[model samples]
Target: MSSVTTPRYADVAVGDALPSLDLPPVTRAMLAVYCGASGDHNPVHVDLDFARASGLDDVIAHGMLVMAWTGRVLTGWVPQSAIVSFDTRFLAVTRIGDAITARGEVIEKFVDGERRCVRVAVSAVDQHGETKTSGSAIVALA
Candidate 1:
């Protein structure tokens, strides 16, 4: 487990990497629950038969759910109040039983007027090292 603490502006620097977050495998049961909660009950994400008919090998996890796993990594390391913006793009499909892990690196840091901010390049990859999502975020440090 990573140690979580409030970050100070003066202590942060470029090139630092946030600790990686390894999420549980995306199972059928998990997909069913996410489908109901997110109202994204698309057959491609919850029904294997429909997914196969749609040309997918099996039901896939929601893209937003993978993004949320990445979000968990960021929020785990930094307070939500310090976050300015977070965004991502889906790169590849995450199928059932895939274990996604979130990773990030500090790409830049700057002082905007009186506010100190840091930019991070983030990604979510599966156990096989295939990148499923990629994004960047800017956070203001206190």
Candidate 2:
């Protein structure tokens, strides 16, 4: 965990090693629920045989799911209404049963006209320390 002072939102250069999220381990059932709720039923994320046949060694977790988990971390530091933008890049695959974590840090901050904005670096890593998703976020603070 890191500091959550949020001085960046005040147009000050402040950043810290943001707390990491101990997300529940990935599983087929979890993938299915996300698929059902999000309408992202790519077989490669749910069917092991289909995934292997398609060149993947096994079924993988949805990139967006991991991103969502990463974003959730910021909600505690900054109010949920303060999140203005979130961007992410999928670096590697996350497998079912793997424990994953997300970490973030404030990178830069400036006023976007009248808005107090902060740039945050966010990443999700699997048990192997393999980065599954990485990106930045711009948040508007009250």
Candidate 3:
């Protein structure tokens, strides 16, 4: 696993790619922990019976949990304060036991007032290469 390094604004380019983070598999226990911390006790995400009754193969992961993984790709590289904004859309359900990879690429880099910022196209893709979430973020460079 490669740790994200702070990007130097002067050396950054629009096409630069962020180091991808391969997250651990989504286990049932992991979902439970996330549920406890996030206070989202949705049975669809934690109870297999509820999931099956709801027409799913098994319990799914919380969308926000997956989104947070995408955010980790940025936070690992930059200070939290540098993040100006982030938004994501849930594209697909991430079922239990699925391995997800967080990916990002510098789509645009420019000046915002006196601050240098970079806009990145970000996504969380499963082992099957299907994207579960897609998003973008704006991060100010130090």
Candidate 4:
């Protein structure tokens, strides 16, 4: 097997942009699988009737699922071992049929306890261009 080479500290810049990951449109089936896998079987996510009762027109996707997509954008750019921290805030509900795209950009570069690192601003946006989730991550560079 071949090892993937991560970016070196000296070769990266503060404004570098990571490749974006575009996900297929969200679907009820996807939500069902995610619900079972994540054990977050909130009725609002899988039950349209329950969602309507909760004041929503239809079932929504789990926030964690969108956050996971952002995480995928991060790890797809850099090895998971390079990630020092990651977090996100749910800004809006993701409805079924909404296509999501995960994007990230290096906002700052610094050294933490002798380890070179970059602070990356990350977000997941729906096809409407609304950000459904926003967060940042700290990634170490060799």
Q: Could you say which candidate leads in lDDT?
A: 4
Q: What does candidate 2's lDDT look like per residue over 1-142, in tens digits?
A: 5445444444445576666799889989999999999999889988889998999888998989999899877876776667888899999888888888998888987789989888889999888888889999888765
lDDT of 3 by residue, 11-120 (tens): 88988888789999999999999999999999999898999999988898999999999998889778777899999999999987799999999999889899899999
Residue lDDT tens for model 4, 84-139? 99999999999989999999999999998989999999999999999999999999
Q: After superposition, how far is residue 41 of candidate 4 from its true place, in Å?
A: 0.9
lDDT of each: 0.88, 0.83, 0.91, 0.93
**Error of model 3, residue 71, in angstroms:** 0.9
Report the candidate with higher TM-score, 3 versus 4: 4
Candidate 1 — which residues are off by over 4 angstroms?
1-5
Q: What number of clashing residue pairs does each candidate have, in the order they appear?
A: 0, 0, 0, 0
Model 2 has a clash total of 0
- Say which prediction, candidate 1 or candidate 4, comes out ahead on lDDT: 4
Shift in Å, residue 110, candidate 2: 1.0
Q: TM-score each candidate.
A: 0.91, 0.86, 0.91, 0.95
The TM-score between candidate 4 and the true structure equals: 0.95
Stretches of candidate 4 exceeding 4 Å from the true structure: 1-3
Candidate 1 structure quality by residue, lDDT tens digits, 1-142: 5466668878877888898999999999998899999998788988889999999888889999998888887888788777789999999999878898899888998989887999988899999999999999888888
Q: Which candidate is the best by TM-score?
A: 4
Candidate 3 Cα misplacement greater than 4 A, ranges: 1-6
Sort by lDDT, top down from the best: 4, 3, 1, 2
